[model samples]
Structure formats: structure tokens, C-alpha cells
Target: MNTLEQLRAGALSGARRLTLRADLRELPEEVYTLADSLEELDLSGNALDDLPADLPRLHRLRVIFCSNNRFARLPEVLGRCKSLEMVGFKANHISDVPAAALPPRLRWLILTDNRIEALPDELGRRARLQKVALAGNRLTALPATMAGCERLELLRISANQFEGLPDWLLTLPRLTWLAHGGNPFSAAQEAEALDNAPMPRVNWADLQVQALLGEGASGHIHRAARADGTAVALKVFKGEVTSDGLPGTELAACLQAGAHPHLIPATGRLSGHPGGADGLLMPLIPPRFRTLAGPPSLASCTRDVYDPALQMAPGAALRLATGMADALAHLHARALTHGDFYAHNMLHDGDGEGRLGDFGAASFLASVPPQQAARLKALDVRALGCLLEELGPRCAQHADAVQVLADACLAAAVDTRPAAHDVAQRLRRLALPCG
Candidate 1:
């Protein structure tokens, strides 16, 4: 939220990253002064409809975010920036995406909540592409050319018009995280999910909201007390389409997931919100609980990050893995895929006890054909494999056994990957020996 006055005053001369949110109608001319050092730019929350044709003058720029703006099309100048790799234009009216608008080195592209109906074949030509967010758009089909992006690991195509998924999408060797719910093909199943969940309505009047606990991409969480004086965590949706999908779609998926020991126990559905916002009620996490790991970095692209010095006993490592495996199995039994299955979503105490949270990227599996569902399941297993690999050497002992299971989850043949139930069962067996 830096003011334009500071930028224009040359106060940020040596800044490598600049963010200005002053309702700018166009790129500030002062930005060019930092062309030699600027590496990132954030011009979100403005009224901008376009970027200058010579925006590439920022030769050192590598990332740019222009979300919540008025662009009707992606700026073609973006492709000309030789160092640019990350581009975000979420929540715009963008429809046409010219082939010339995709940079050759593009790795991460965020075009969520737009009106795009088709993607240029050139999108596939970016060999470095890894993460793509295209949810909340009008896309009916994806270009077949995208099959060549061998390094792609994460994709979000939910809440779009897609009638079905393509075969190549399932076989992507590196694609471990995905979401495709709330589309034409899955709308009926989404409705079924909303209707079939046995959730209780928790009236907003029954609770007293307290201090904010945390905020995420789609909502704010607050600590609250129920009518019975019991503490609970209340998550109120922002009621907007996020890069992952609609908040309402995510809320439905969580209700459908029900309750499990390894999952954050969602006790009731939030109702009678004065603001008309969708939300959920769950047991409040204690202060001792914290995220097991951090989300991906610009360099990691799709992998969660753990402390380099992180070390655990053989039993602790096995216990953590087993609990997560149990959560994954529970989710799959209900035909749900936790699309963003990373350590960052796993909350744990100092010990091995943990629960998987965050349904923002979860997708229903009931709608996809059996073959496609199988592939998606394999994708889930691959995510588990990555987690296992991430924690492999961190275990003081039994690292070999952990990697053995990881290799099985990461098997190249989709159909050959072990089922979620089997993975959980195997982990339970592995933990018994270490204990």
C-alpha cells in the first residue's frame, strides 16, 4: 500500500520490489527510474486497464502482480520482458489472451476470475511453466499443447465451464496438485455434495466472536465461544472467487468431507451470518498447534519448504506420516481430493499429533469418470510421495523405509500407484515397528 508520492519522490531508488496501490489509472512514470534494480512489481487494487507497450524496460523484472484491476486482456508487453517468469492478473475482465502475451520463460501464471474462454497454444511452449491458476473462468477446454509442460506441478481449473478433463492432464508425470470441481461436468455432483452432507446448522447468534485468529486467501478466521461457552474456530468466507475457486464451493466440499480424527473436526455449518457470508464452525486449535511447514517459495515453485535443520526421531516421523495418510484415506473414501496437499496445510503439536486443514482447493471426485478419478487419486498419492520425500532424511533413523514408501506413491504409472487406504495401512504398519 505504498503511496505514489513516495515512489515519485525517488525515495525507493534502490528498491528491488515495489508495490503501489493508489488507484492508479496507468503505470507510474517514476517506476522506470528503478528499471536497473526492480525485480518485482505489485500494482494491484488499481483501475488499470493496460500496461505500457514498453513495460519491458524494467530489464531486471522477474515478477509482476496486477490483480483486482480492469484489464480486458493480458498485456502483450509482458512476453517481451526477458527476465519475467511470474505474472498475476487475477480478478480482471480479461477475455482474450494473445499468443504473444505469454513469456518464453513463464513459470507461474495467475489468470483466475477472468472471462477467458480459450488459451493460446503458445501456453504449452513455455517449457519452464510449473504452476498455473485458471479457476473461475469460462474455459471449456484447454489447449492440447499444454501436455508438453513436463515440469508443471500445480493447476487450478475449478469453477469453469469445462465439461470434462483431457487425458494428457492425468498423465502429467510431475502434476501432483490439482482442482477441477464446480464445472459443467461436476455441477450435478457439487449439488449432491451440498445436499448429502449431514451437517448441523450453528446459528451465528449462538456464538460471541472474539479476536481474529488468522486470515487466508478467501476468508478470515476468528476465535468464538458457543452458547454453551465452548470455544470454536469460526471461518467466515470473503464471498469472492479466489485463485483456487469460489469460496462457496470450498465450503460445500468441507461439509461433504464430514469429520475424521486426522482432520480438523468441522462440527457444524455456519448460518445466519449478519453479513450473508458463508462460513464453518470447528474446534479451536490450541496455541501449541502450528503449521508443520511453510508454503512453496518462488524457487521451489510447487514444493513446501521445511527447516534445513529440522530433525525428528524415527517414531515421530512415522507418526506424523501415518496421521496424514489416514486423513487422505478418509477424504478419498468420500470421493474428495485435497487438491493442495502440502505440509503447510498440516497443523501439528510439538509431538506427532496433527490434523489436515484448508479445503479451499479441495475438489469432488464423484463426477469424473472412473479412469479419470483413478488418475486424480494417483495425483493425490504423488502429493503424499512428495511429503514423504521432503521429510525423508529429516528422520534420524528409518529414512530408508520412508523413502521406500515414497517411491511407491510416486510411481510413474498412474494405475499402479497404491490406493489411499493402502498407503494409510502401510504407514500404520511402519509406525508400529518404530514405536
Candidate 2:
């Protein structure tokens, strides 16, 4: 939130990061003064449709955010910045991505809530690309060349116009977290889940909403109490498109998830909001429980950010891993994929248990062909492998077995990866030594 006055007065001189949101129509010339040191620039909520042609002067810039702006296309100058790796232009009017707009070293790109109908073929040229957020767009097809991006891991293609998924997309060796809900091909499956589960509906009038627990792109969660004197957590979904897809799609997935020891059970669906907002009612997570880690940051892109001081006892880590494995296996068995399977999506009960939550990115797998469903399951195995690898160093006793499983899960050959059920069974067998 550094202001133009601060820049003009040189008060923010040598600053490594800068964010401006004063309805800027153009980037002030003074901003270039700190080019020698600036590495991150956030110019969201502005009216600017283009960047300074000389933006490449910021030689150290590695990340830039221009969300909520008037840009109709991705700025071409960004491609000239050699150090740039992450770019965000969410909530803009961007309808085109020029071939020269992609930087060579690009690793993560966010174009959510835009009008992008197609992508440049050059996207596949970036070997380091790992995460891409293209949800809520107008994409009918993806560039065939993207299959060359072997390092890609996380992708959000939900809420788009694709008639079907690209076949090459399923073969990416490193892809794990993938969300394709809200597409034409997925609509039937989503509707089927809702029809089959038929979650009990709890009218909003029967509940007393309390303090807000947390909020994200899709909705606000609140501590609530039922008229029958039952305490619950109510998630009032924001009736808008999320980075992944529609909220109703998420609710259907949650309903279909049913009950698993390691899953956050949905007690009922929120019905009859005065304003017609949809919601879900579930058991309140115990106060002692907390998210295992923070969601991915700009720098981490697709990886969860753990507390540097956080360490889990081997028993605790094993317990948490086994719980997540069981939850995921149950999900896949139901022909569902918890598209966002990061540790951040799991809640850790201080003792040893972990509960998988957040169906915002979940998608149905039953509709896909049998072979592709198996491939999708293998993709999720890679996600579990990534999670285990992240929690491995924290384990004290069963570190070897955890590492072995993680490595196998991350095998370059997707078919070589173990199934979620197999991994869960193996994890259950490891009798971790008590502290």
C-alpha cells in the first residue's frame, strides 16, 4: 500500500516490494526509482490497461500482481523480464494472452475470472511451469503443446467452456492438484452426486449464526447453533464463481463424500437463506484443532507453507498421514478426487488425528472413462506423495517408510505410483513407535 507521495518523497526508497491501489490509471514514473531493489509489485484495483513499456527495468522483479484492473490482455512487456516467475491478473477483463506475453522463466500464472478463450502455444515452452489458475474463463480448448510442460503440477480449469478435458493433460508426470468441476462434461456427475446423496436440508431460520470462523474466495464460515441446541459450523457460500468453480458444485461433492473417520462430515445443507445464499452445516471443528499449514503463498505457488518451527512426533505424523490417506482413498473409491489435497486443507486435532476438509476443488471421477479414472487416481497418489514428502522430515520414528511411500508416489511414470487405497493400507500397517 505504498502511496505515490511516499514514492515521490523517496520514503520507500530501496524497498524490495511495493503495492499501490489508489485507482491508478498509470504507473507513476517515480516507481522506477526503486527498480534496483524492487522484487515484488502489486498494482491491483487500478484502471491501468497496460504497463510501462520499460517495466523490464525492474531487473530484480520476480512477482507482479495487477488484479482487478482494466487490462484486456496480458502485458507483453512482462515477457522481457528474465527474473519474473509469477504473474497474477485475476478479475480483469483480459481476453487474450499474446504469444510474447509469457516470460521464459515463468513458473506460476493466475488468470482467474478473465475472458481468456485460448492460450499461446508458447506456454509449453516453459519447462519450469508448475501452477496455473485459469478457472472462470471462456476457454473451449487448451493448446496442444502444453503436454511438453512436464513439470506442471497444479492446474485449475474449472468453470470453463471445455466440452471435455485434453487427453494429454492426464499424462503429465507431475500433475497432482487438478480441478475440472463446472464444465459441461462434469455437470452431469455433479448433479448425480446431489441427486443420489440428497443431503438433509437445514433451513437458515432454524440456526443462529454466530461469529465468523474464516472466509475464502467462495464463502464465509461461521460458528452457528441449531434451534435444537446443537452447535455447528455453517458455511454461507458467496453466490458467485470461485477460483475453482461454483459453490453448489462444492456442496454436492461434500454431500457425496458422506462420512469417513478422517473426513469432515457434513450434517446438512444450508437451505432458505433470506437472500438466497447457499450454505452447508457441519460439526464444528474442535478449538484445539488447527490447519496443518498455511495455503500456498506467492513464492511457494503450489506448495503449502509450513511453520518453520513446526515438528510432528513420528506417531502424530503417521497418524495424520494415515488419516489423510484413508480419507483420500475413500474419496477416490466413491469416484471423487479431492482436487486440492494439500496439507493446508487438513485440520490437525492436537493429539494425532487429521480431518480432510474443503471440497471447493473436489470433482467427480465416475463420469470419466475407466482408464482415465485410474490415471486421475494415480494423479492424486502423486498429491499424497507430495503431502507425505512435506510431512516426512517432521516424523521421528517412521521417517524411512514415509519417505519410501512418498518417493514411490512421486515416480516419474504415473502408472508406477501406488493407488490411494494401497497407500492407505500400507500406512495403516506401519506401527509407528510411540514417543
Candidate 3:
């Protein structure tokens, strides 16, 4: 019963961004009539099968979220919105996504949890496209033209029918994040085999346990050195730490997959320790823990490490920060989130380089609630901010670098925070700024 004039006035007077998911079953005529001035719109979690045809008239619109709907076809009007950059149609009934249907300037397109069988060649040819989330679909193959998307960084196609990943996708110059594990079209056989793989045997006597590196409510970390003189950090997890077995497994998997130069890669697992405890063996970081002075406080070790002044050259600080950023980006690209990202968990190799050391809290986006996942990201951002603050006056010398770090740490909201890849890019730029 709402009038167009009333709706238009309400939209104009109210918030420029409108979310009309509640108390609405169908697209009200008044809603579309007021679209001209709208900059952002979210109609997700609704029962609509199709969008209002007049959506293209919203020349100023930038973001549109229609996920969790009943739409079976691509919205034809989207191509007309010149200003449109982000479109989220996840959890919809969409089966086909016409390449030409998307706007040229579209930067983010999320079609996860849909019926999409394949993407149009032109979809990947768009130069401005940066992120695409198409997980939980039926895609058997990716368009070859996707190679043309020079700026694309994230491509998530998990839970699909792929037998093998597209070679081109693996070779993407800018594509850093890729998650296609669950797809039958990719390496399903390998992944399945890994799930049932036997655990490696461990000889406790052969491994010399050094000083206690860290401790948590659920586990304790010790610096262990093998007889061969190979040193590694051993994270011994108490059996009763978490009721959920999947998170623990995922944490181990992510660390194992990550072998970056600056990342504390997981070497293998260690089970059947004293008291029937389980643990993981990772590369031993340098003895000098730059983030902390002596040992961490009970509170700090239980949570995360936060140290401000370790006193290092400006170049060393820059290298450490940049390396950490790169490692985080690598994890993010894999659609994995380090739920516990803090200074204590990060270890500096003493050569001005750093590595992400803990994976006990890592998880995949599809496995965790979006809201909860967002909170984890927010925590990481807060930690990043705290780390910058701890850097103190040294940060002032590199104002531009510090600004980028600050922005990543102090974004208005979790969703607004820069992606790990973007954070790494900003760090790289700030590392070498013009006078």
C-alpha cells in the first residue's frame, strides 16, 4: 500500500543505503521507483525470484546484494548500471551467469551456493574484476578468458564438479587466493585420500624439548630440537581443548599447505604424547622472540603476544611487517582465516623477517558463520593496529606506511577492512614511498 512518492521520500530522507529483506515477500513497486538515488541496496534472504526490472535506472548505485533469493536467471538490468561495482547473488537459484550481463566495472561478484554450471568467457575478461566467489556450485570448468582478468586476486570454487583445476587459473599473475578443494573437478581424489591418510609416527625421546615457547588454555608450545640438529616448535594440544574436531584438523591442514618463505610452515603432526595429548610440529623460529622481551605474561600467552619496542633497524621493521602481511595474504587467498592473529603468535626469524606461527584457530569461511568469521577478522585487525601502536615513534618516520597499516587496523568495520592481499599490496607500496 506504500506510494512511490512516499517510498522515494523515505529513501531520500532515511539512509542512502537501504536493506529491505524483512517484512517483505515481493519486490514492492515503491522500492524500485526510488532506486534512482540509491547507492547501496541489500535484498538478500528474501523469497523473490527476480529483481525489479527498473534497477538499471539507479545510475548512482554501487553495490547490490540479492543473495539467498530464488532467482534462477541473471538480472539483465545489472549490465546497465555504470557505477555498479559489487554484486552478491550467493545462495540463489541462478544457474547461468551471462558474461555480458555483468557491468564492466564490477570488482566483486559473489555467486556462491548457487546452481551455476559454468562461467561465461567474458566474465573473466573483465579487466576490473578483482574478486569472485562461486563456491558451492556445479561448475565443471572455468572459462579460459579468465586469464585476461589481470586484477583478479580471489577465486573461490569450492564444492564444485571440477576434476582438475584449470591450468590458467593456477597461472594467474594476480590471483593469490584459490579454494577449490571440495570440487570433484579438481583434486578430489587426492583430498579424499589425505582425509584417510595414516598419521606419522613420532619418537619423543629422539626429539629434545627446549624451553616453553608459548602456552594457551588448551595447549603448550615447546621449542624442540631433533638429534639431526633440526629445531622446530612443538604445539602440544590437550585432548579436552575443543569439542569440535574439524577446526583442529583444519588448522593443521592450512599450516601444512602453506610453505611461504616467511611463514612458520607445519612440518607434521605429533600424536600420543603424555596424557594422551595430540600436537603439531612446526619449523622452529629463532630463539629471539622480538615481539616479547623475556617470556609472555600468563594473560598475554593465553591470548596473544603484544610487544611494542624490540628496537630494530627501520629496514628490519619494514621487512618484518611486509613479510607478515605477505604470509597473511597467502592464507587469505586460500579462503582460510587465521582466527587467532596476534603478536605472540607471530615469530620473527631474527634476520628482520617474520613468519605466522600458529594455526590452532584457523578455519574456512564456509565452515563458520559469517558473523563469527567477521569477528575473527576484526580481532586480527585490532591486533594489527595494536602492533602498529607498539612500533611507536619509528612508525612516524614512515608515515605513509604507518597510515596504510593504521587503515587496515582501524577500518570502520570488519567488512570494510582491507583484504590480506590488499594489505600486502599497501605494505609493499608504503615500504618504498616518495619523499
Per-prediction TM-score to the true structure, in the order listed? 0.96, 0.97, 0.53
Alpha-carbon RMSD, candidate 1: 1.6
Point to the candidate with the largest TM-score: 2
Q: lDDT of model 2 at residue 174?
A: 91
- What's model 3's lDDT at 167? 45
lDDT of every predicted structure (CA atoms): 0.88, 0.89, 0.62
Candidate rank order under lDDT: 2, 1, 3
Model 1, C-alpha of 238: deviation from truth (Å): 2.3
**Backbone steric clashes in candidate 1, count:** 0
In candidate 3 the C-alpha lDDT for residue 287 amounts to: 60
Task: At residue 35, give the lDDT of candidate 3.
Answer: 56
- Candidate 1 lDDT over residue span 1-435, tens digit each: 567788888889989989998898989899999999999999999999999988999999999999999999999999999999999999999999999999888999999999999999999989999999999999999989999988888999988999899999999888899988778888887787777779889999999999999999889999999999999999999988887787877888888888898899778888899998878898988887778889998778888888766555447777888899889989999899999899999987756778898888888887888898888988999999998897766555667978988999998777788988898888788778666
| Runs with alpha carbons beyond 4 Å of true place in candidate 1 | 308-314
The pairs that clash in candidate 1 are none
Instruction: Locate the minimum summed-lDDT window of 10 residues in model 2.
Output: 426-435
Candidate 3 has an lDDT of: 0.62
- Write candidate 2's Cα lDDT for 1-435 as tens digits: 788889999999999999998999998999899989999999999999999899999999999999999999899999999999999999999998998999989999999999999999999898999999999999998888999999999999989988887778999989999988888888999888777886889998899999999997789999999999899999999978788878878988998898998999998987899999988898998888889999998877888999887755447887788889999999998889999998898999656788998898888887688888888888889999999998776666678889999999999888789999999888888744442
Q: Give one digit per residue, the lDDT tens place, for model 3 in 34-83.
A: 55567788888778777666677777788888877888987877887888
